[model samples]
Target: MTNPTANDKWFQDRAVEQIHMDQLKRVELFNGRAAMLGIVIGILTEAITGSGIAHQIGLGALVDGYAACRTQFLPFCF
Candidate 1:
């Protein structure tokens, strides 16, 4: 027969583990969002900086910026 205290401790440990897992998931989600935001911000910064006065303002700047940001950001993923 399992001791009552042992069963309670097991349940408590499981609960704590679940909570930690949930917190980790939240952190992952937050990090993903932050990374996405960083990419977007980087792109916008590049585009704003690149928009020449003569041209009709194009998407090329944004794309280039995204590429640059990706290269810079990928290393952090590891």
Candidate 2:
């Protein structure tokens, strides 16, 4: 006969692995969404700020900041 305790342990391990996989999927989805939103916001900001050398510089900075924040803080939010 199979040991009930060993069977339960096996099932529990599989469940934990599944949960980790789901969390990873959610994180990837969130990252993609945040990246797209950042691009849109950067373009809009540049447009509203007006065309000039300053606008390009500002847009680059904004996009870089957004990427940094998304990488550093988004995991905690998720």
Candidate 3:
């Protein structure tokens, strides 16, 4: 017969793993949202500024900034 204590430990481990996976999924979701928002904001800024160069630079910078924030402030976020 399987030991109840071992079975409980297995379930506990699985729960921990599932929690980690959920957190990761949330992080990915937030990151995607941040990137999309950055893109929209960047496009609007470029349109207002009337500069194609600004559009490219702004988009890249905003996306990278969001990614950096996600990595550095993930704990605070979720």
- TM-scores for every predicted model: 0.61, 0.56, 0.64
User: Residue 46, candidate 3: how far off, in angstroms?
Assistant: 0.7
Clashing pairs in 3: none
At residue 63, candidate 2 shows an lDDT of: 42
Better of 1 and 3 by lDDT: 3
| Model 2 regions lying over 4 Å from their true place | 50-78
Question: Which model is ahead, 1 or 2, in terms of lDDT?
Answer: 2
User: Where does the lowest 10-residue lDDT sum fall in candidate 2?
Assistant: 53-62
- Which digits, one per residue and each the tens of the lDDT, describe model 3 over residues 1-78? 999999999999999999999999999999999999998887887788766544367544334547646666344443
Runs of candidate 3 exceeding 4 Å displacement: 53-78
lDDT of 2 by residue, 1-78 (tens): 999999999999999999999999999999999999977877787688765434466543334556646666334333
**Whole-model Cα lDDT of every candidate shown, in order:** 0.71, 0.74, 0.75
In terms of lDDT, the best-performing candidate is: 3
**Tens digits of per-residue lDDT for model 1, 1-78:** 889999999999999999999999999999999999977776776688765322234444334556546666334332
lDDT of 2 at 28: 99
Native-to-model Cα distance after best TM-score fit, residue 61 in candidate 1, in Å? 20
- Candidates 2 and 3 compared: the better one by lDDT is 3
Candidate with top TM-score is: 3
